[model samples]
Target: TPLPTSSPRSSPNILITGTPGTGKTTAAGMVADAAGLELVTVGDLIKQRNLHDGYNEEFDTYWLNEDKVVDEMEEMMAGGGMCIDFHTCGFFPERWFDLVVVLRAGTQQVYDRLKSRGYKQNKIEENLDCEIMQVVADEARESYKAEIIMELTSNTIEDMEDNVEKIVAFVNGFRSSHK
Candidate 1:
């Protein structure tokens, strides 16, 4: 594999996180494309990892055997330059990450998106509070040693692309400054 930056670069990793409707997947995809980095989503990976046995929905809060997926990510981290996407940043050691981008969408926007996705009232409240209180942002701050940035989305495809571009710029600047 071609190294992420041949300019005597330091390793870098990012966590693209937020509530369900906050565009974590979309932002990670676009940011990875823009930055020419690998985009890895822990939840999807975990789901696939557990597909053979198929986990119940309740396990998502804190997967019973999360270490299995985290172990894989730890191995992947050795190669560096990865954009890790997940609503909750529970697995892997915090030192592996370089930055945390907490994507946010307004209450009405999130309610609309989740409603269309068929989320029930209780689930909706959980996510709505996650956004209102900036839970992901707080989580990242609590877990990682790196700086965190917030990007607000309007629940539009264009907003995802735009914010991803902005994150790419931020990462580029971060890499440059650290050099």
Candidate 2:
């Protein structure tokens, strides 16, 4: 199916994506608040909506049904002014977002965060590997226009503050341009 175009809304739709433990949820909350956008945490949405096909024991997570997720999000995304947060982005339609922010962090920081969350060693290692390899960033590049894809570091509280400021600025700019 051809992707639906972003509808003309008062604010832009933004996608904040990265490997798990990269502070996507935190940054998204701040951005959504600052920019007056709604925050959609994909993982939480999946669970709340039963959008997953089943659970994965090894991963200790749901096996997401990507198509279902896209369908569930289609209308909201097209309307714009949403901050979509997820660890992966390639499955979402390219036209849904006005901007895609791929957050990254130091390996040690990711490791500490995941470990503190009680993630299994294997899962933690897998995420660390993904972070080291820039998997999420690469996926964003492949999924969206390069000009709209931004890579930001999220290693410290200072970095989070700076990132939120930058993202809010972008949102303001988008609002002005769209107006």
Candidate 3:
């Protein structure tokens, strides 16, 4: 393989994926705010759809393709760099990116957060199960090259920021050496 360059040859689409109420949104927002990146939430897409919000019973929520979201983000790159944030990195096209960070949350911790946000019990439980089962991570691993999928645990706000920093440093390091 070619030696890593000093910076990203092109902008990278970074996905911060995790279960609901695991601070994916918050962490994504913070990263975007701190780094001037684009924040895209799949939940927001479902909410915007203003149509069907029902899950496929045993499966996790699905509103749209994270890759399409990344595509939209690509449009907003402003000819420089940007971060695209979401909860499911599964559908993302691996070759399109240099990195994919998967955030994880414990069931109880996740339940509490979702409950506090007024999520229904079944919805909360389903989401928690998705996290516990590592569905998102699995999908990401399968879709992307192993090197691109990163697993992170986020139990608190600090965890989210720490995860963000880890990803940021990774990106920065990647940039420092990549063409």
lDDT of each: 0.71, 0.90, 0.66
Model 1, 1-179: lDDT tens per residue?
11222323354677788888877887788788889779888777776667224544642343446567777677777656789988877455866766677788889888988889887788888889989998877777677653344545646778777777777776676677656
- Expressed as tens digits, the lDDT of each residue in 124-160 for candidate 2 is 9999999999999988888887778878999999999
Assess every candidate by TM-score: 0.78, 0.95, 0.76
Give the poorly placed runs of model 1, Cα more than 4 Å off.
1-11, 51-54, 57-64, 146-162, 174-179
Candidate order by lDDT, highest to lowest?
Answer: 2, 1, 3
Where's the lowest-lDDT run of ten residues in candidate 2? 1-10
> Which pairs clash (backbone N, Cα, C closer than 3 Å) in model 2?
none
Model 2 spans with C-alpha error above 4 angstroms: 1-7
Worst 10 residues of 3 by lDDT: 1-10
Which candidate tops lDDT? 2
Candidate 2's TM-score reads: 0.95
Which residue segments of model 3 deviate by more than 4 Å? 1-9, 45-80
55-90 per-residue lDDT for model 3 (tens digits): 555444454544455555554544435565666666
Best candidate per TM-score, number?
2
